[model samples]
Target: MENRQENNLVIKVHESDNVAIVIQAGGLPAGSQLGEGTTLAVPIPQGHKVALTAIAEGEPIVRYGEVIGTALAGIARGDHVNETNVRLPEAPALENMPLATRPAPSAEPLDGYTFEGFRNSDGSVGTKNVLGITTSVQCVAGTTDYVVRRIKNELLPNYPNVDDVVALNHTYGCGVAINAPAAIVPIRTLQNIALNPNFGGEVMVIGLGCEKLQPSTLVSDQPVKIYENSQAADPDANILSLQDESFMGFEEMVDGIMAMAKGHLEKLDRRRRETCPASELIVGMQCGGSDAFSGVTANPAVGFATDLIVRAGGSVMFSEVTEVRDAVHLLTPRAADEQVGQALLQQMQWYDRYLEQGQADRSANPSPGNKRGGLSNVVEKALGSIIKSGNSPIADVIGPGERIRKRGLTFAATPASDFICGTLQLAAGMNLQVFTTGRGTPYGLSMVPVIKVSTNTALSQRWHDIIDLDAGRIATGDASIADVGWELFHMILDIASGRKQAAADRLGLHNDLVLFNPAPVT
Candidate 1:
């Protein structure tokens, strides 16, 4: 993992890696020496790979000691290695992957790490005390949105303790195959989001009575009992139907929702933050706008923080099905047991089928932005993306939209899309999110505070207000992964305890929640 930066800075991850990524701010010009004997045959962009030795035609292009692709043509030393000259190889076969061969590292337990969080009766903790209004169908979204604005502007000020009001609006619940097997993904996602600990167990539903999926069906009848001290009212009692004959006009409908929201707000306002152990933390890990530096810097730094979280008895989840697909073999061996290993394979196979159903395949990834950032294809991108999980034994696996009950690192299967992954993580019970980015994005969630880490100092300098931490120091030799990891851990406690606010939260930058609905829409 050492990089020589005195001359032309280039990162060589492993001794066997035939290529090292260029780290110069403006890239190195042709004939520039890279400290190594090799000279640049051509100008290389920052983050792009530079060949260290001549690669014969059809030879494997290696990074992280794995074949990311094959050379399409002969290459000279220091020649740029990119999608143009690289041909993607077949994804590793899902069968016969090593299962649970690596043992979990033994480390002294991390103690006395605590944060101020709202305690819920369900024994789960909440970082934010919010009122979440769930909608049974998109038909009620506009009305719910209007009422939520009213709740925030009008009633929210009255109840000083409630953090915020969010309309759990989505494009599901109606005009789809409600009974389809795949429908459970989005349906359970919405149901579990309402149960997100941040909502403080006060659930309200707004619906149009004529929809195929009824409001009562959206929330379970025994939802209150799931929590130990839950004082939630009946799901039916809190549901407000816009088309219920009692409402004469739109104003009446808005008033009904407003009144319903007030009761929830009052209960939520009464709740106060209390000191909770770090073990209560459920952190979700994700990466977007990734470049080659992601695996080298930010993601690895996050991986270190992830291990710290798990060492403290806290839970951490790393998701993105396609991102992990190519690197699944590396993960399967780290599973806690054979069953967990199989579960990892199951998710990969399911997603493989999903892509095929859409007439697509794994190569669909490495978005244009990704390629511009030095990722030649999905394999290269995946090798960089999975670094955030750290080296913990994956204790469990959960499919899309399923709630995670096991602690430690769990692989929550989800789409590679930023919004979908965040939404599913919310349903999986994440109270905070640490997102790493190299290419840069404004992605954020209204439900949880997002702590953004920039993969490079350049992006950090340009987007100082948005990025919470700069891991690029690792590339420049200013900091080690442990330095940034410990820093991020302390920062998480501060942000989760309400002592600090994330930049995204401060700017009110939130992306809309997008549900993963694989079922056919009619």
Candidate 2:
């Protein structure tokens, strides 16, 4: 098959569906056969729908093998199907329904799953080799910044393989209820950063002694160099005192680290591509700057690839719990067990309560940009947002910053905010992320490489540097969803091995962070 195209056509998303949708416009005849079980006539503009078979009024219209809407009027084969004929269904009532359940698979070992990665002393595999300077509180942020500036301008050039010099800065640590048991949250967050597989070498942690978050107490068996500014009578004087001397010492330390890193990189580069078992793959699905096409093209295509990953024995994670509010019913049935499904429901309930207490409507989503792109309500946006997970069984539900212990498909329940969800997913040990966007986004995490997929051709052309793949072709009838999905799968493997740079990396836009907040202090 031809690799990519520049036209639009109607496509039948599922065999059970009686209608097809328009993906693109131009250069097609009234009666043209495109692929197996699909045909078109005239041009169907992007976001418009077409009929696959005759449909009677009130019958459900299926996309991605689930009901996206119901027919409002009788529709014929070869005719456009859209808002005129289809209306969104009422939110599925999940409170009374028994949670969805799925049978556990008989243990089938995944075959040949491995990546060229750094093996830490602790046995965890790292995707990148870097030296990090972290701070325990906002007060120490400046010190960490000074340390990083000195390293980046003077020491880092000597070590070309070191990915970056980053200072983890945040707004928390000193203010608010510091004595609350919840204060452990910041400490745990810091530990997660140090333990992240992205950091292959030593880390220098700096902290203000007066802060409730004591840097000395957060020690780990891992290799880290801790420094407390409070010990010095003059903190600024201490910083100046360590400048030149510490710079020279750090340069030598970096040289040795780079030598070891060079050997690791060479070995990693020598590792040739092999057919790794799909089960070894763990994917995180996220959406931001969404538009109407988000649910129609990129989201479902991601879903297709997600299914392929699962069948290959790899795992996938879907977050942004609030965005999928109305669509959770569709996912519950696929849960690994009733309890898993119930856990998801309970989390959603808690999210609703939190929002209610804040005097915010749970349905007030689809940010301004989303509405400008033809999305009307949170319900409409969410109906399309959940497509990225595919139809894999929901094997588990993970809390914020929690590690995903099981290997099957999982749901990391996080707020709809992109940065917050991204941080949690990376903390949960997701090495790679597939972020879909219709409006375009330039955000990425410090450690994990984000592969940005554009839902429309216009956005892809406008922001080619940030978009790694274009799902617009599916909308334009230029590529089949399955074909695009497989193409993305290979692209992911290449990215994992550092063979390709994601759009965010190319733009140097990788310093976004978000703290997952589950409740509010009233």
Candidate 3:
């Protein structure tokens, strides 16, 4: 619930929540009277929390009806509740938690929605028709990039049906323990990204002849879960080796790549958009630069949209393992079954071990930008971040860099870094993504269309050119989550259908693909 007293708007998420966030831009002054006989004990920044009731030291500081932290000292009513005065709380125990105990979702099925998309021979749908050139080793990224630019400027004009040419460049495939057990993560990531639906199944690979990770291994029939009928065969035909004996110079290498790309472009240019059901859409949900309003507005609105997409029989993925670690207890019961529930726990436990191995913990998250935006710690941030998942049953779970197989909601485990999370989602077959931010970011992906949703109207209006939607209306009481959600859902279809372009795409913004290489350097 929310209240406006003396022109001061305060948002309290739950009745049991003893704190409420100040909503006024630039914040309110000390002595300002808030509702419920509460007066500002001190000035509070916008999106920062204010204690609604006085509590003794060592008491739990609650938000979203969960303990986010413990007060380090006695806190007075209307005082600020922030990291300085709050100590981090222990994470929830993973043992003996409820599993698949929530009742099945009963929302009426959303029907009659369709979008124009490119249908691949593999029976997968593509939101964009692009020729993707994959590089097996980082040694070939420069040459591949040069070829991509040449193809885009020289050959792309003739292929009017093709959308864009992307160089799948990353810093992997060399100087690493290629045979390490964890090496499969980056290797398969490179492979599955080649099979992304938007590439139109015209897979192309470029590599240096003597690199540790061979180009053939990328397209080989391994366990990367290649889409059915995908073009993952005849590696010699698909790969262009820059260091081959026939390539005498850099120019020849460039020409060789462009020649291969032109062939893929010709096939991609022959593809046309056809009507596909909403179920064909695979959307990845992520958040960055989050403030308290991330949960109050943007994420919840995205969550509502997530539920809508699930109802329409489409697939949705919510990732960022550390961001979800502290809130895993809230999700276990929502799993589709005991097996799915256990999968969720396994991913959480795996991430926990991964963090421990690095001598890090969940405290490493809720970055400085996040802290400045009023996220006290990872615990508070986790509660807010999970709101992007909505209330859908956990249909399946996949580890880092694995492809999503089932429809509906799936938790794709990934680190909290914005670039890494986005890259893995691409490998997992996401054709479109919706990212929420509050402190603001210019983050975009070259492989997919990313819809940026701002958690506050200030950010939306400030970064008007880049932000696709304003979920801030929910915080200001100008709209409901359902209203913004429906708008977002419609926008997703429009962008997926190529009927409308996201602001990021229109502005030609893109981030480099950063692979998650957990293996050791050899």
Candidate 4:
């Protein structure tokens, strides 16, 4: 079990793994000599692999203590373990197992867990205090944007605590049937935006007079002010004036909202390190721009972290139900109840029907980039993707834009589109998101802080600004998955308390919204 360093190359992560990862590059030949007792099994590159022992075909290749795939050919000691000689085993169908048979995790509370959030009038907490400028349709998007642009450049400069002035503009809202199913979709989407935890104080809705959607119809008694385009000679000026008055009069009316925000930041400055119970945390597991290493490195590490969070009584949610495809059996036995399992099955069937009607299969996922990254099949991609959910009981299933009510582990129904799913997840009330990627993406929601994790060291270093954590070390054998998972957990808390800004936030990449278009009915 002794690892000796040679020629600037070192093996750091020594799990009970049959392989060791090369951590640095050196001009070592295939038969290069190492320490007195060691020799090169193969020429290894930094962030690649080396064999610890001879592997036979069909033998399981273990990394991060999970069976990633099996060896395809006989491999000698110190040989590089990669795709040429490795292939994933066919996953077995899920059995009908009872939830009670699964191991029960101990009840533990997250220690000293608290976020400096705005406590809303209705008791919900908000991470950001936004003053939203909303419009009902694309026709009014220009007006809405004009109002927000004026506020951002002119008014918000005075209000230092207001995070940003945002406009909820969309392409849809007109040209679609305004009947039961059609209208309900956008209506619910708008309502979710209005009630999102990001907005604390107030919102101003501006609607074009003749649009299918109306501002008056959407406005409720929820601390919102409305102004129709028909009401003013200059709507932008009126809105600006209203904003000025609102910020001015809020000192007396809102009483302590600003002061509370300021005090919360001060208290948040004290960062005493403490191990909180895992159950107090809720993790949103997600992947985007995935590659082969995704399942092996980042996604599995995220899964291990998900397990830690779940075992500690915290919850985790992973979606993209359509991508589950043939892997539904893997999750069914873990369902909290028969109803939950049935609900998942029903959703899968519905998605299949929808896809078939379009003469397409949802399995036509894994974009061109994914294919180039060494993933060949949707099942292979999904088998790896599901690792992010960790090993937990599937306590519940949630529909699109639905609030996460049940506590334990749940599966949310979100499409494979990252922006749409991410936005919907945020709207579903996830306080934060843990997004893993290999190719990299700059996407974030308005309120929820997305922590971007890289699956490989090269991407992590190349996109350092965007990637918050690097599980690539797992691939290079520099760190264990569990250790990386621990690091990720703390990073979550750091972002939650405003100590860090995910790359998406720093880039101001928050143009995400729920898409509500449906297939046209005959």
Candidate 5:
């Protein structure tokens, strides 16, 4: 890389912007000049925005050429733009918004992309082959987790083709409003996770026998209890009842579990990766620990790569309802048709009501970490967040945990919380993930490959062991969004083909599954 020390130091996200983010690592100090005469009134931290010119109180602070927030006090040229100076704005009403407002996605379709993936019997392809053991109730989690560890030590070594053994555990079942109208949500989430393509459709359930979420209903979508393991010998064998009388002690319990797990490992060991088209890839896109450069660099590069995947007939999901809520108008118009537009609005409305029911608003978001990183409010974060969808037409919109039947860019409705969002995306059948972080996180999931992209080179350099791509190069003029995007796009194919391991994968860093349970807890 060239000596970019003298490179353009401030990033003005849009030409109409009244503020720009300082890109220098230590930030430009007071008296330092940007361009010719914009002198800093105060030092601005890296990723923090600087006022472009004098602006009156109550005026909109623009970023990405959109109304991200309003200035709470008069801001002068070279002043730092912080959340205290930027007031949060109200969310848009769902009624009568424009529908199908944009023409078909304008990015030319990409072609000839292929990857080596695990093609399943159901026509879906996965990037990894793993044995997943799902717990029907939180009560059995301890026992099941023990079984998973035992399998890893004693059985996994013999199954070279299987990537891992993930215990799909969560805090639902037995307690709380199981029969409530919204209870179906968490149930559906756990059920689908068991069916995630990466698991090779090998559904193994550990039930307490008395939990409301019985294996019968949890695995209702699949052939029930058809696992080759015997129910008579280790009657505690499968359909599950950790309390089954057949289990005399901990040893008997362990034996039953090992019997079931061994069967899964043996079958999974026969699976192999084969060359597959990029269309078979189901990718979930997300961002965490974000900063201003996210919209300008990493996410945009992700957006470009998103377009590449969509054009190749692959499914890409950009989720986090709160993150995209404010910028949704930009999305509805890009919907494939009026139905998609309506569906998009409906989900937004649902989330709006969901928030109101809790007596909260979108303003409650854009966490303290977000504020420190220069996101003035949720609106600005949203504007930057939505760009990950690129300009691709949203072919469909699905509720959390619902599998996407259509390819192209699909919006999966989920809370902005990283763990829950990733879990929902996994249930939606994503075999791969692209996560952009400006502030940075070590977040990863065991079920799929999560490729991390840094918004700035500084973060990439610092966390090179964790971040897979340095999108910050775009901020320093070292690379164009297209340059990094093409690099990332090819990287996705390689990663999807299992030819490369993401930093998280290499370090074995992963987060636990967190189901989206809106029903009342008992």
Candidate 6:
């Protein structure tokens, strides 16, 4: 397990699968033997699949026990199977899928799992003690950043109890069809993001007075209400409009923002970390830069850890609509009830229509990097991606930016793009996040602590300083899935308790929030 010289070999995901990914570094040369009778007929790149048996053209190239694609050409024994040899397949039909067909999973309460976290005025708990400066529109982003930096330099030391101050800047909030039917997604996303549990329920808004998304209308509350006239009724919501006559100069605007941020920081400074039950953790699971090993190594390990959180009465969220679209049949039956199953379908249908309007389909997924990493198409990617939820019964289907009120595994509808997905999950109240990558990425969210898990040892060693955990040991037989899962479980508690900072947080590597505005930009 220490080195691949003794263990480099092909990895077959399932017994019935005909294609296996090459695990040997730099790939194996032509005529190399991979088990008996499976001789390489051509070069196979690391993490790319090779044909385990001869197959006729148009035959199914199976991986993960499901059809990834059909062989576009006759693939001989040990031939490297890639996009050139495999043709994408149509997605699984969505209608009439089975509902609640599986038995309910055990609802046993796990013991002794707790973390030191900030207790908020609301019932919610926070993993960080930071003042969040949210914007109603993007116009005030520059002013907001100046204010946030100043607060961090001159003001943050005075309020040592507060972690840091951040400007929640984004590309939306103006010059869009805000009245369109599809506009609700981005609007609610902005609203709910301000309400993220990490913010300690301290809502602040900076806006340009003439923006389409009015400051008064962006208040986020529970029960999923949409303002009919885009107006807010919460008088207590803090809003600093830069264009207000109260600010006649640039200095005044910065002063006004700094003044408001200080108030929030003072309140945040008083908050202290206390022992809280693990149930307070609302965790979001996602993947990017995926290679074939993603499903085999990292995702399955995350899945095992997901169940652990659920047993501890914590909530785990798995999203990315297109990534899960092809696996609805496998997932629908695991729903907690018929309604949950229906909710899954409704979200799927909405995405289908959304993509159709653009004349593209799920096939648009599995980007160039994915194919290079041996994912032939979306179907193959879906099979690997869906394993992140483990076997926990889905307790709820959260719409974009909606709040979660229950504890268990939940599905939050979002596109598969890494940044957009993270934004939507943050809006859904994810105080912590676990991200698995195979080809490797430095993706992280600004508002949450993201734990990066690598699928293979190569990536873990290469990006040693950045990746937080390595599930790659399972692939090399150095550790079992359950072993790595428990390791990650404990790591989550450490991160949540502020005993450690994830690499993303340490490097300040964060992407600006990208709202999923399906509405047309006017």
User: Root-mean-square deviation of each candidate, in angstroms?
Assistant: 3.2, 7.1, 3.6, 8.0, 2.7, 4.2
- 420-441, model 4: which lDDT tens digit per residue? 7776676566667899997777
Candidate 5 TM-score, true structure as reference: 0.96
User: Compared with the true structure, what per-residue lDDT tens digits does model 5 show for residues 16-85?
Assistant: 7777888889888898887846889988888898888887899988877788888899998888888888
Poorest 10 consecutive residues by lDDT, candidate 1: 221-230
Candidate 4 pairs with clashing backbones: 109-277, 110-276, 110-277, 111-276, 111-277, 279-312, 279-313, 279-314
Off by over 4 Å in 3: 1-8, 221-236
TM-score of each: 0.96, 0.75, 0.96, 0.73, 0.96, 0.95
lDDT-based ranking: 1, 3, 5, 6, 2, 4
lDDT of 2: 0.66
lDDT of 1 by residue, 266-379 (tens): 788889999999999999999999999999899989999999999999999999999999999999999999999999999999999999999999888989999998999999
Q: What's the CA RMSD of model 4 in angstroms?
A: 8.0
Off-target runs (Cα >4 Å) in candidate 6 are 1-8, 106-108, 220-237
- Model 5 bad stretches (over 4 Å): 1-7, 226-238
TM-score: model 4 vs. ground truth: 0.73
Model 6: per-residue Cα lDDT over 400-474, one tens digit each: 878776899999999999999999999999899999999899898778899999998898999999999998887
lDDT of 2 by residue, 1-522 (tens): 112222234445456656544444333456666454456644555444566777788887765566766778987766666555676676566587556654544444435545555555554555556665565567756656665666667666666666776776765666656556545445565567666666653554555556655554444644333222232322111111123233356444334333332333333333233333445466789999997678767888888778777776777889987787778887788887888998888878867777887798654676888755545456667778888887778889986677777876888878888988887786677767899988888877767778888888988998877789999877776677787787787777777667787878777788546665442222
Score each candidate by Cα lDDT.
0.89, 0.66, 0.88, 0.63, 0.86, 0.85
Q: Which clashing pairs does model 5 show?
A: 101-333, 176-522, 234-237, 456-472, 457-472
User: Scored by Cα lDDT, where does model 1 land?
Assistant: 0.89
